[model samples]
Target: MKKFIMCFVGAMLVLSLAACTPTPVKQSESATEPMVEASTGGASDKVPDPNVEPMEIISVYSSNEDATGLNQAMDAVDELTAQSLVDKLIEYGVLEEGTEVLEFDTKDGIGTLDLSKVPSSGTSGELLMLTAIGNTFTENFELDKLKLLVDGKNYSSGHIEHGDNDYLEYNRDYKKL
Candidate 1:
């Protein structure tokens, strides 16, 4: 009876060990092939692929929240990676909706942004806009300063004053009024 019990225990242990073992899966050669056909067309045909992963969303300062002057009002804008930061700010009502980026260029550590329209607002509003725009550009680009222009002319609002060609230091800090 002892011999039979010992043999039964040994068999049970072997079976348990076997049950816990993992099985290897064999993959076919076709499984490693490309899933989609490569495009052979020109550069214009290279539109954004829907199957590709989407870009990350980001937050920016909003003028509406700047009025309170207690906490920074950072508004989340979606699907704005393709759009310019200024456009996103405008869409968020930080600037006038009619404001358009005519041309933007960065060279020799200096960045220039030419706009077709400029928002007319109070000094505090202008300051908030400038801070938001300056921060956005400096944070993204490698630049020592930024020059903002509207229709090839200098930009001056109630409180802010700068020449059409003057380079303004990139400042991200904002003070509440």
Candidate 2:
């Protein structure tokens, strides 16, 4: 009688535990078919494309001292856009010809530019480069701040100093082209 009671209690406990546990949801194969069809598009309906191209306007700075004004253009923006903009500055004599952006990343609303490949110019030159970069990124990403890393170390723009991990806010008023 004791064995029977213990067995009954154990069974009840197991059943109660099982009842409290959530069951795995089983979806029918047909239910998933609609989602797949929607992604691929159906004969009658048009599905919105997810791979739409990104349109970005870049602010390109000229090297000429007299040309403080920026030139703007609608271009396909990417990580390399930072490098291209810097290269344009160098070509025009705004930045040193060898200056380049090695890598770029935007995470958690903070944009970082790796300038390991770029050599150090003077404070005035660095300030100009920084302004051009800040303006370009802010305009495109709507970001109010950015970080510059030179050779894996935090780079000070000389105009606005930022801590090692701090993001520098865009403070320059760039003239539109």
Candidate 3:
């Protein structure tokens, strides 16, 4: 009798273990295959009749964030403005007696200001060069001010032809102090 009971218990345990095991689904019998595709930025027909236009990207040379209601500050950096500014400075006699700036291309947060033509006998002009430029531009145009960069980076205060000392600096928190 003990032998019979031991055999019955062993069979029951095996059956229970088999029932607990999970069976894998046959791939051939499955109804659908998995599918995945990369998604892009595009509007679906879900929102019909949306008044939207294509996106336009442009480089901003200057903006007039502080000059609200004034559109002059948002002027795009262009050749005309650059040439005018250079001419104005020369006319203003800020370049000393013999200083001659060959080019003034300030765009995309970068500038290539060349002043190698300063006359041999003219007074050295570096201190007021950048300040005069900043003042002249800000005064005439309604812009949100500009930051000067050399070859697309912040310029250091070096000597001429280096585009040094032409950056714009501003303070964000001034009221508390």
Task: Name the top TM-score candidate.
Answer: 1
Each candidate's lDDT (Cα)? 0.67, 0.63, 0.44
Cα error, candidate 2, residue 34 (Å): 59
How well is each residue in 1-177 modelled by candidate 3, as lDDT tens digits? 999999999999999999999999556556486644456556752465567553322222221343221112223223445554554455555444444445455455444555534322212234334444554454444333455444354434435443344453222221111
- Highest lDDT among the candidates is held by which one? 1
Of 1 and 2, the candidate ranking higher by lDDT: 1
Query: What are the runs in model 3 whose C-alpha is more than 4 Å off?
Result: 1-80, 96-125, 150-153, 159-166, 169-177
Candidate 3 pairs with clashing backbones: 63-144, 64-144, 72-142, 73-142, 73-143, 98-119
Model 1 scores worst on lDDT over the 10 consecutive residues at 68-77
> Could you give candidate 1's per-residue lDDT for residues 47-66 as a string of tens digits?
88888765645545555453
Ranking 1 against 3 by lDDT, winner? 1
Residue 173 alpha-carbon offset, candidate 2, angstroms: 2.5
In candidate 3, residue 140 scores what lDDT?
44
Candidate 2 per-residue lDDT over residues 59-159, each given as its tens digit: 55433344554444444445436676666556655556677678788877778877755445666556555666666666556675788777677775545
C-alpha-based local distance difference test score of model 3: 0.44
